[model samples]
Target: MHRPLPTFRVNGAAIRTIRMSAGLSTSETAERAGISRRYLNHLENGYRDRMRPGRYAALRTALGLNPDDQRLLARLPHEEPD
Candidate 1:
């Protein structure tokens, strides 16, 4: 059977964490990442799916995230450990 494609369900907490680490306002980050402030807010609120790849790359890069973080952001959020 074909393998399933990985989902893109970035957790809002992760987004907020990275943003805070970078000491960036949502508007500033959104502008730098080439996304709208409204869209970024939605992403941070966990109400959106599938961020634009370029924009996602921009956010991760601007946040100074390493490869693992980049990889993690590209996939769906993990379930809480049971």
Candidate 2:
């Protein structure tokens, strides 16, 4: 069954939590995710809400998110775009 993509949300806190749990620093995660450190920092600090779809996919891959984790993230409340 094809699952519809969940409503887009800004779960920066969740991302930061997961990153910390994985023992990766912002720089490390950014490098691994093929994104800039500044961008990662913005996400972690909740300065930014939405990232490009490609970047979001890269982040999920970089974070090594399991299926359940992915679901949890999907369900997080959406943030208003700035």
- Per-model C-alpha lDDT, please? 0.71, 0.75
Q: TM-scores across all candidates?
A: 0.70, 0.71
Q: What tens digits encode model 2's per-residue C-alpha lDDT throughout 1-82?
A: 9986544454788899888888999999999999999998888787887776668877877888853455214343354344
Per-candidate clash tally: 0, 0
RMSD of 1: 4.3
Residue pairs in clash, model 1: none
Off by over 4 Å in 2: 1-7, 71-82
**In candidate 1, what residue range of length 10 has the lowest lDDT sum?**
71-80
lDDT of 1 by residue, 1-82 (tens): 9986544556677888878877999999888877888988888887785665566677777667764675325343474544
lDDT assessment of candidate 1: 0.71
- Using lDDT as the measure, the top candidate is 2
Q: Give the C-alpha miss distance for residue 61 in model 1, angstroms.
A: 1.2
